[model samples]
Target: MPFVIILVVLTVPAAIFFCWYQMLVRKYKNSSFIMVYHKVDRYRGGLKGLCVSPEAFDRQMDYLYRRGYRAIPLGSLVDSIINKKDILPKTFVLTFDDGYENNYVNVLPVLKKYGWTATVFLNAGAIGQTVQYPMQPPEKHLTAEQIKEMSGRFDFEPHGITHRALTGLSDDEIREEAEGSKKVVEQLTGKDADIFCYPFGEYNGRVINLLKEAGYRASCTTLPGIVRQDADAYQLPRFEFKETKVWSPRYFFRNFDFYLRTFFAI
Candidate 1:
């Protein structure tokens, strides 16, 4: 009797939540959100909380597709907003920071299956080389050749040259890290890198100006919120799945709360 009572309590809320989500799936069918990700590897390394296993990533992609969620480029989303155009609903901006080699080796194929593309904010300094860390194993970054190869499925944007916080740098130093990396990616991709993300999600007024001077159209921050029509382009907010339990009821509650406040003015 105790177990049955507990099950009833749980199932009731779950059923309500499921129905709510299905309704939202239709109501917000034309809305957009930016989703953050890092490595898509089976790597079980320490300090890899941000990494998603390939199998899990594949499953997540499948879930998103079935839910009517689709991926769009960051530039395209920003352009639509800037041009006063309506965004395609059920769309999200797929963004990966640090531009890990696993993106090419792992993430690309999964995205290809879904007919989705991603935007990778590259650590411009380590382009075409291995990324070395103080107390961690060396990880290779996306090389120029590999970047070119996957150009069809990826939009490589500038993160920074050294992956440092731009708020701590002087104007000239910021330019070098900002504009310099922009130049590198432009030359490699042969397309103007308009949208970028703040390294470590750090930026300030000075950093914003430096980025504008470098000709960036917008910047994505780690700030947790939905992207709306009136969102500040410089301080654009993004959200990430902090755990592997993608689409669980827990996340549904989290997103539902945010959706109420953002869309319904809770």
Candidate 2:
């Protein structure tokens, strides 16, 4: 009887895990993935994982193209969600965070080669300056001139005036980050900055309300999951594509299988 009891305890949890895995698999299969990239350069001595080499970026784009994956702008995805329109299978939205100058130097050429577009979230305060975060080198973030030059190909949005977490700030501070960044981006690009990316993907209900009050149409988060029709426009999740997943064929398949198993497992 004791042996039977132990067996039941183990089996019950395993059964529950199995059911949850299956639900994730179904969700993944039906949803669209939004991929976020940071830097595309060959010299990521310390920031290896966050930076993808130019060659890897080109290869990944080629793979997506060869597989017939459609890369659409984030705004189109938002429109479909707002209007309750169906998102096609294999649809993806490419996003770049931090507005690194390499985005202009290395990323732009690859994107142009594929005739694709991407949305870049800029640190409004860091424009034309070499901003260094912990463990990251002093790298040149995008300048206004460079931004204007590529304005035709990429959509620029606010990533905050100072790249600080929104949840940790005062109400007025939150407003400054959201509204201030929006104004800066608009002045630079001659377009309304409707979308806001939470700096470091940190936000609370208050931050969301502040963004709404500041006239933001939507926001993106660092949460990892496929974007569904019922997803919150203010808290949309994105998949961060790393070099390991993009550069290795075996690793890519293994990771893809894991994503399916972990997200869609039912």
Candidate 3:
């Protein structure tokens, strides 16, 4: 039995090769891939450090251009996942959470250069509200007017009323967080927000249902994974792009196993 187990382990590589050969004999199959981004800025004070830098962001977009990755809007992504439509190999969606002013100042130009459109999730309460908690700083929040102007160029969605964590809140609180932002955005932009991005990517079944009740077509989680046909649209997963772009190669070329852990069973 010990020798048999050892032989099985030795034969595993051959088994994988056989399977690879069979796949070559059969038609190759590819799945849809989606990538998510948060902020794009220099590594410094506050939460801006977590976002991708201007140079790195440019490089990433350039790489995609050279590689033939076509950009898609968040709405199209929701439709594709919900309808189980085939996404091209060179297709992806660019999204940003928190609606930081840098998105307008820095990231917008880069995206414009590539003719790419990204989805920005705004916290209605924080739209023009100043941050008085940790530090006193003034950052523009893509004002209602700016949001409207940017409409034809990008998709503006809802994050929450105040970017509060919903995982520890009650059902009503969760509903308020989800529904309130949707209403605020709809009123501000005169366009209904169909997508919701969970603040800090924290949510559970209650939060999910509350988002649905709030009329959100889909919501994104910070969990890293690929969008598959069998995956849940409400808890869709995403990978955070860093300021350094050190892992862009591996991240952009993620495989099925990575998606399995990041998207499903979350």
Candidate 4:
């Protein structure tokens, strides 16, 4: 426990340095960020990247709350981009990839408790299938009705129909992966979603163009960085919050300036 505690503590300064390097030293000085999550579960198998454990999750939320950060919905972010408006200070967007039912079972309550909003990227074909990554056991994806209900709190965007690797697919296949997802979500919810997430952050210029043709306002990747005004709306970078030993509330706060720098720094 102490080791975990220390690891978390040590990451604070490193995160600070990273912020300075990216935000202050970099040339692009517009600061915006989007945080990514996949699953929020208990720490198991010394897996340090799941963003697991309720206690750690609570601490992270508390840090955000105390910082007076607003957890804006992803749709609002899209609107901000189109309108070319400034995101308020300490503004952040929370997004969860893969519509894990646990998000409905677990993460939803936490967000509700904190009065936070997030976006859930769902894979249409995988709604009731076994998980492939990090080896989470089979679980139902959020049901259509369930998703509709949750959409009231969080935006439900498309990851894809089948969580396939986009880089491996043909142009037509890519369109199915990209355009098809938009259609699916729209048919189900009767609402048009302009937000998308690449499965595994796999993309190319063609994929980006396909996303635009599909009418997505923006898309998220697995790349680790923050969003800035000049940053490409599509292929926007996100920091994945893995359940690592190097996680702590202080570490998160110390990295705020770093994230700001990464997004805004020149």
Error of 3 at 146 (Å): 1.9
Displacement of the residue 70 alpha carbon in candidate 2, Å: 1.9
Residue-wise lDDT of candidate 4 within 115-160, one digit each (tens)? Answer: 8888899897776555555454455577877787787678888999
Clashing residue pairs found in predicted model 2: 21-265, 22-265, 22-266, 24-263, 24-264, 25-263, 25-264, 25-265, 26-264
My TM-score estimates for the predictions, one after another, are: 0.82, 0.82, 0.79, 0.79
Q: How far is 7's C-alpha from truth in model 2 (Å)?
A: 35
Q: Give the TM-score of candidate 1.
A: 0.82
The C-alpha stretches of model 4 lying farther than 4 A from their native spots are 1-30, 43-48, 129-136, 245-266
Ranked candidates (lDDT, high to low) = 2, 1, 4, 3
Q: Residue 140 CA error for candidate 2 (Å)?
A: 0.3
lDDT of each residue in 131-153, candidate 1, tens digit only: 76544467889989999999999
Where does candidate 2 stray beyond 4 Å? 1-30, 244-266
Give the C-alpha lDDT of model 3: 0.72
Name the weakest run of 10 consecutive residues (lDDT summed) in model 2.
257-266
User: What are the per-residue Cα lDDT tens digits for candidate 2 across 1-266?
Assistant: 99999999999999999987777656655457778889898765666778988888888788777766767888888887777788766778889999999999998887788788889999999999998887887888998999999987799999999999999999999999989999999999999899999988899899999999999989999877678887889989887778755547755663463345333322
Alpha-carbon local distance difference test for all models? 0.80, 0.84, 0.72, 0.74
Off by over 4 Å in 1: 1-30, 244-266
- Predicted structure 4: lDDT: 0.74
